[model samples]
Target: MCFKHDRAVGPLIEFFPRYCIMPAQIISGSETAKAIREEIAAEVARLKTAHGLVPGLVTILVGEDPASQSYVAAKNKTAHALGIHSEQVTLPAATSEAELLGIVADYNRNPAIHGILVQLPLPRHIDEAKVLFAIDPDKDVDGFHPVNVGKMMLGERCFLPCTPHGILELLQRSGTETSGAEVVVVGRSNIVGKPIANLMLQKRAGGNATVTICHTRTRDMAFHTRRADILIVAAGVAKMIKGDQIKEGAVIIDVGVNRIGQTESGKALLAGDVDFDSVVGKAGAITPVPGGVGPMTITMLMKNTLQAAKQAAGIE
Candidate 1:
């Protein structure tokens, strides 16, 4: 099957093309996140020596969902690698909402704990809203607390949702000028789309961009996308956006990670929302699925945890 789309434009931006002989700049999320982690590590060392403080992250995991368990483990491992104090609280699948809230309450008052993260999609019996709000705003490293969310919208210094904050770092660090640029975000989930769009509209570096959000109900997705200087596709549908929908020279960030199926030998395979092969030729800098945005999310969580630690220690 041919991957090329009929729609044509100016010279190709040649972004990160996967398994293709192309000249695009592959934005390596691992590289970007590694650099940021190094900086965080240095800061961690400074905090320890100067103030005898080690930033701490507490993860609350409920049930045995394989994917969630793996994610929490990765976060725990990364926190320790960076010298951040890490704790994992695993509860049975049948744990009550009150019990979980009680755990949050305990961590909130604990001086040693700076960041509290509750792995999402809690058991059906738990009231997620109650549990989310139960976390002290300063310790809500996931940025899901109402206080942090409101503060972010108002352009205050608060923990940003990890994925979106990481995406912003990718753009700024990669030298993509967001100021006055036309940006189109393809998803509207509170996690990725809404927060990213709000970040773009902010008066900050990697922000101040004109943003348009396209979701399932939106008409003319391609038309909006083709006008973007920066195109972010977070729609969960696998390879949903094709090359024909992209604008040449547009920077593509693939935030969607979906399991398409098994590979030829039965290994699990993953794909992004954009048809990367088709869009790769046209993008300026593209983030490859699995290697791109995925790594940055955890790195940003570390950033948030460090910040939370700073706030608690009264470190300006």
Candidate 2:
């Protein structure tokens, strides 16, 4: 059941109707993230000029995993391009948990490094929690430190997790009124779903939305999704949410990036939890798989690093 709303976003928006097929506006995360990065760059320049402080981000990669290496490289490249000092610390897969903790401790006490990010999926032998706990909360731009998490839970000033914060930015920038809206998140990972749900529930801008989190044990997933005014899917299963599963004119945010298969030439391709083609007409607005949540994640990391730098420099 599609309802008509005054959405005058013609230049960069589309509205889907019930009787016929019309694509909803495609929320371009790439475009949003780029705009944000540019803004952050300007701020970085100002910080250097007025306060003589350069925001520095040090990303610690614990293994030679190809995907992790690529992600860390992309983050470092973006940080430098935005005028933030970036460093990469690579540790062999066999590095012990204690050794990694020592490195984290060194950076924690180093005033030059504002943000310390330990890339996820650390080696099985390493205690990831111990390493995260070792980083000073002020330098924990990844928002994994217990202190930061506690502050966030209490609605205090704190660095937010990148992926979830990115999702919040997308909703706010895209003109989605999260307050009082019915939001359904289809995952429970600490990274995306849990944080997003907590964020949306907060009584803040782009928050206060009635949210429901569904997981594998959900008896009827489609029932909850169909009721959402804003649906955020991070189930990690490619193309899990189909067209008919969503309500007409619902806004969809896809956070899961899974490689379903390959192209005809055997090149790798990615897909999202929400079926893009199928949900195109069903949703009021939706994000594309690759260009959706991916860009925003890194951009938010930059924002966190900038904030950390401000804190370090004693500049509110």
Candidate 2 pairs with clashing backbones: none
Candidate 2 lDDT tens digits, 101-138 = 88998998888999999998899998889888888999
Candidate 1: residue 15 lDDT (0-100): 38
lDDT of 1 at 229: 90
lDDT of 1 by residue, 1-316 (tens): 1233224521232332343344457899999999999999999999999999999999999999999999999999999999999999999999999899999999999999999999988999998889999999999999999999999999989999999999999999999888999999999998899999999999853599999999999998899999999999898999998888887778999999999898889988999998889988878789999899999999999999999999998997
Superposed model 1: Cα runs more than 4 Å off: 1-22, 264-266
Q: What is the lDDT of residue 36 in candidate 1?
A: 99
Candidate 1: TM-score? Answer: 0.92
In candidate 2, residue 305 scores what lDDT?
99
